[model samples]
Target: MTASPLLRSYDDGRLSLPNRIVMAPMTRGRADDVSAVPHPLTREYYAQRAGAGLIVTEGLWADPLGKGGPGIPGLVTDAHVAGWREVTDAVHAAGGRIFAQLWHVGRMTHPVTLPDGELPLAPSPVRIEHQQIFTKDGWLDHVTPRAMTTAEAEATIAAFAAEARNAVRAGFDGVEVHGANGYLVQQFLAENTNRRTDRFGGSLTRRLRFAVEVVEAVVAEVGAERVGLRISPDNPENEIAEEDAQGTYRTLVDTLAPLGLAYLHIIERGAYPALADLRPRWPGTLIANFNGPQPTTREAGEKVLNAGLADLFSYGRLFIANPDLPTRFAADAPLNPIRENLIYGGDAEGYTDYPALTPTPVG
Candidate 1:
C-alpha cells in the first residue's frame, strides 16, 4: 500500500499523529469491580495493539451513577487510576499513544446498574423502547428515566470535567468524549429523545448544548488539542433518531469547529453525506470510521486517505485481529481472523491470543 502524502504525519494544533490509523476504543468487560481496577489481561490487551499510531481505550465511566453495565471500568477512584496507569504504561512501553474514552449511559441504564438502585437520569422522563442494558446480575431492559433539573445538568458537566482531569492523571495521552451511540451526551443531542423545553432542548442549538458543553468543559479541564468527540449521526440503536440528521450534526460540528479539538470521529453508516460535508466544514482533524461490520481493508483505508475524506481512519475488529495492524497494512500481509464471541465478555481466549505474522522460511 502506497502512503498518501495526506496520510503522512499530522501536526497542526497540539495533536500529532505519525500515521493515519487509530485503534478505535472497544469495550471488553475485563475490569474487576471489587477493586474497580483494570485486570492484568487488560494490560496485555493494550500492549498487543501498541502498533497502531494511536489507541483509544474502552469507555471509562465518569461516575458510578453513570455506569451502564456490569464489569465496566471507571475513573472516579484512585484504584481505577492505578489500574489504568498500568494499561497506559504498557501501551507506552510498547511504543503506543493512548486516550481514555469517557462515558455516561444517561437513560440507557437500569436500576440494577446504579449505585443504590436509583433510576438513571435523562433530559426527559421518557423510557427507551426495546433497549437492553447490562446489570450486575445480567441484561435488563432500559427503564423510564427521570428528567434532570438545571442543577443536575450543571452537576453532569462538572462530573465530565472531573473525569477529564482524572484521565490525564491516569497517564493517558488524551481523552475522547463518548458522545455517540445514543449514550448520555448523544441522547441530549437528538431532539426526539430530548423533549425538554428548557435551554437544553426544543431547538437545534438547544439540543446541541449538552454535547458542546461536555466538550467545552472537558477541554477546559484538559486542553482542546487533547480532546476528541465521537458521534454516530444516524444510528438508531437505543431508540435514537435519524431525523434532522444533517441539521443536528452540522450545528454540532460547526459549534465544535472553533474549539480546535484533536479530532472529530464520525462513525460511518447513516451519516456519510453529513460526514463528507464536515471535511471542509471542520478546520481541525477529522477521522472517518469506514462503513460495514467487517473491518476496512487496506485498499479501502488507502482510498479514503488518498481522497482526503478524512485525516485518519479508525479500525475496530482489524485492530483486534492484527495487533501489529500498522505493520500489517504497511507490508500488505494477511490478517488473522478474530472470534466475534470474545469481542465482548469472557477472558483472554480470543482477546490476547491473536499473534503477529512471522515470515515463512524459504524452502
Candidate 2:
C-alpha cells in the first residue's frame, strides 16, 4: 500500500518534520495546584507520544495572572523552567520535537483560578456571556473582567516576549503564541469583548494591534524561525464574538507576512470555512485543525492534505488515547477509547497509562 500523504516528510527549512501529523495542543490540567508547575507524569505523557512529528504542549500560562484553570502549567518562574526542562529533555531524548504554547486566558479566568483574589483582566471590562469557567472550587459564573490599563497592555506584550525567552531556555525547539480560542490575544481581536477606544481597541487595525504586537515581541525575542501563531478566526469559543473575523484575520495574516514565522495554525469548524478564506493568504507552512469528531480519522486527515488545503493536520483527543497515533494510522489499527472522566486534573491513569502499539514478531 502507498504511504498516506498525511505521513509525508515535510522540510520547509525551519521545521524539518518527520511526518505531517501534528499533535495539537490541548489544555489538560495536570500541573501542581499551587506552583502551577507541570506534573512529573507530564514528561512521561509527552515522551510516550514521541511518534508525532510535532507536539504543541498544552497552554502554559505566560504569567501567574495568565492562568485560566486549576491545574494548568505556567512559564513564569524558575520552577516552571525546571519542570518544563524535564519534559523537553524527555521529548528530545525520544527523538520528538515540541513547542510550548504560551497562553494568558485574560477574562476566561476566575479569581479562584488566579493566585490573588483580583479580577481577571481583558481588553475591556466586558464579561463573556453564555459561558461558565471551571476552577479549583467548581464551575463558577463568569465575571466582568477589569479593563487592562494602557501600561498593563504594554507589560503583557513584554511578558509574552519574556516567556518566549524562557521557553527557549528550557530547551524547547520553539514557542507557539496562543492567539486563539478567546484568550488574551483573541479577546483583543474580537469586537464583543474589546469595547475599548484605546490604541489596543476600536478601529480594525487598532483591535489587531495587541495580537500583532504580541507576535512581534515574541519573534523579536526568539527569532521568527522559532515562533508560530495560532488563531481561531471568529471562533465563538469562550463566548467570544468576532463579527468581522474574515477581515480581521485576513489583515492580521497580511500584516504579519514579513515575519517569516514557522507556521500559522487556524482552528476551523462548520461555523466558518477557515482554509477556503485564509489558505490563499498564507504562503508559508499552514496548519489547519479541523475540529470534527473526537477521534479524527486518518481518512479525514488525508482528504484535507490531498486537497492541498493544509501543510499539516493537528489532532487533539485522538492523540490523548492513541499514544502511537501515527503508528496506528500506518498500521490501520483499532484505537483505545478515551476516559472522558479522567481527562483532566488526574494521575497517569488517563494520561501515560494508554498503551502503545506492541511490535508483532516477524515471520
Candidate 3:
C-alpha cells in the first residue's frame, strides 16, 4: 500500500507508531476533586481517542505540592496508581499505547492547593503576573512564591524519580517529564525566573542543571528508551522569558543529545525562530506541536511533516472534539466542533459524549 504523508508508519527505535499522529497532553479537569484521582470519565475519555498513533496523558502532579489546581490528577499515592491502572487497561484493550506526562507546577500553584497553605515554591521569589490559580473557592491572583533552597531542589528531583517509578506501577508504557510551559523545569531554564548563585542558576550551564538532573534521575528509574522530554523555547506564558532564546536552547539541546532519549517534543508558537536551527542539533525523533490561540488542522500537520520539520505531529483541540480523528482524517469526514464552554471542569457532556461516525448495521 502506498503510504500517505500523515498516515505513514514510523519507528523511532523505541516506539513503533502506526501513524504519524499524536494526541498531545491536555489538562481537562475531570478528576475527583479532593483525592485528585482520575474518575471513570477520565478512563472513557482516553479510550475513546485510542485510535491515535500515540496518546500522552494530561499533566499529573508528582507530589502534593505540585498540584496546580482543583481536579488535576496526581501520581503520588496508592489510590492514584489504582485510578490510572483503569485508564491504561482501557487504552491497551482498545489497541493503543500511552505515556504519562509527569508534572510539577512549582510557582504556578496557590497556597489553597498546598497541604499546609504554605507559599508555592520556585527557583526564585518572582511572582507570575496576570495569571490566577483556580481553587475550590474560586480563581485568585497569584501570590509571591518562596525560593526553594538547594536542599529542597534536590528533594524535588528525588520526588520526580519516585513518580517515574509510580508511573510504571500504574502500567504506563513510558513517562514524559514536563520540562516545558514555564513550570518548575522551565523556571530553572529561564534566566529571569532563576537568579540563584548556586549550581542550578546563574549561567546557562547552571540553569540547565535542574532539567538535566531531573532527566537523569528519571532515566535511572525508567530506562532512556522509555523516557521523553518536552521543551518550549519561545513560550511567554506563566510569566516566562529568556534573555537569549536561541543560545539557551542550543546549549540545552546539545547537553541533552548524549542521553539517547526516546523522543523530544517541542511546542512551536512561531515566536521562536530557533526551531529550524535547533531541530538538526538533536539526533532523535522530534514531535512538533504547533501551538497558539488557533487550532491545528490536519493540513497544517501534514505541512510540517512534509517539510521535514518534525517526525510526528501532535494535536490537542481536534482530538478532544473527535475521538476517531484518524478515520475522520482518512475519509475527509466532518469534524465535531469544539465546545469552548465545556473544555474544562465539566462532566461527560463535553468529555466523552462526542460521537464517532456510526458504522452501518451489517446485513
Candidate 4:
C-alpha cells in the first residue's frame, strides 16, 4: 500500500527512517543526581516513544563544566556510556532508531551547576541578563561567565569529539550536535554574545568558528553520514542576540552544506521569514521544527512537506504525551494533552505513563 506522506519511509541509503515524523530532544531532568546517568525511567521513556521515525535523546553534556543544570545526563564517564547502552538497546529491540544530542550550555548555567562552584565558561565574560538557572539550592541569577582562553576553547572542541566517540560506543545510530536554543554553540554563533578579537570571534566567519570546529571534529570521529546538526537563527532565548541573523545563518549553512552530513534540523517560528530562503540552500535532508506556540499537527506538517520546505517534521510536547504518535496520526486518533507541571523533573508520571490509543468497547 502507498503510505501517507507523513508515513513514508526515508532511505537516503545512509540514514534509514521508517517514517517522516521525528521526536525532538527535550530535557526531562530525570538523570541521577550524582553520576548524571540517565535514570532507569529514561530507558523506559525512549522505549515507549520508539514509534517515532527518529528519537533524539535529551541534551547529553560532554563534560562536567559544560553541564547545564541538576539531573542533566552526561557522556563523560564509563558509567554514562553503560547507562546509555541500555536505552539504545531497548529502542533498537523495539525497532526504533535513536540519536544522541551532544550539548554544552556555556554561560547558560550557574555556579551550583558547575564543578567546584566555578564560573560558567563562554566566548566572552558576558552575563545573561534577567535569567535564572535551576540548581540544587534553587533558581539562582546567572553569574558573569569567565571568558574561555584559546586553549580551553580548543579543549572543549576535543571534548565534543570524544563524546561523539562515546555515543557510538553506546550503540546510537547517529549523533546530533545541539547548536541551538542559546546554548554553548549558539553563544558562539550570535554576534552580540561573542566579542573577541581572536580567530574564533569578530567577523561572521570567525563567530561561526566554534560551531564549525565542533561539527568537523564530530564528523571526523563518526562518519559524516551518521551526524546531524540543529540550529535556531536569531533566537533570543537564553539572552542570545544576533546583529544579522539572516547573513550569519546563511554563511553558516553554506559552510556546512559541503560536509555531506545526514541532515540539518532548523527550528523555525513564523517571525523568521529568512528561514524559507535558507531552506533550499541545504543539499541534504532538512528537518523543519515548527517552534511556534501552536502544536504541530498533521495538516501543518503536510503543508510544509508538500511545499518542499522540509523532509521531516519534529514534534516535542505532543510526542511527550503521545508515545505512539505515528500510529495515532495515521488513524486520526485523539491526542493526550501534556501535563504542564509534570514535564520538567518527574518520574513515569509525565514521562512514560501516557496511554497509547486503545480499542473502543464492542457493541
- Per-residue CA lDDT of candidate 3, range 185-235, in tens? 999999889998888998889999999999999999999888999988868
In candidate 2, where is summed lDDT lowest over 10 consecutive residues? Answer: 290-299
Q: Write the per-residue lDDT of candidate 4 for residues 1-363, one digit (tens) a residue.
A: 334688988888787888999999999998987899999988889998999999999999997989998889999899999999999999999999999999999998888888889999999999988868899888888899999998999999999999999999999999999999899999899887899889899988999999999999999999999899999887778888877888888999999999999999988853566558788799898897877676777778878888888889889989999999999988888899988899888678988899998977899
Question: Candidate 3: minimum summed lDDT over ten consecutive residues — where?
Answer: 1-10
Instruction: Evaluate all candidate structures by whole-model CA lDDT and list the values in order.
Output: 0.83, 0.91, 0.90, 0.90
lDDT of 3 at 106: 89
Decide which is better by lDDT, 2 or 4.
Answer: 2
Single out the weakest 10-residue window by summed lDDT for candidate 1.
Answer: 2-11
lDDT of 4 at 178: 97
lDDT of candidate 4 at residue 271, scale 0 to 100: 54
Q: Rank the candidates by TM-score, best first.
A: 2, 3, 4, 1
The runs of at least 3 residues in candidate 4 whose Cα sits more than 4 Å from the true structure, single-residue gaps closed, are 1-4, 360-363
Query: Candidate 1 on 233-256: residue-level lDDT in tens?
Result: 887767888588887888788889
TM-scores for all candidates: the values are 0.94, 0.98, 0.97, 0.97
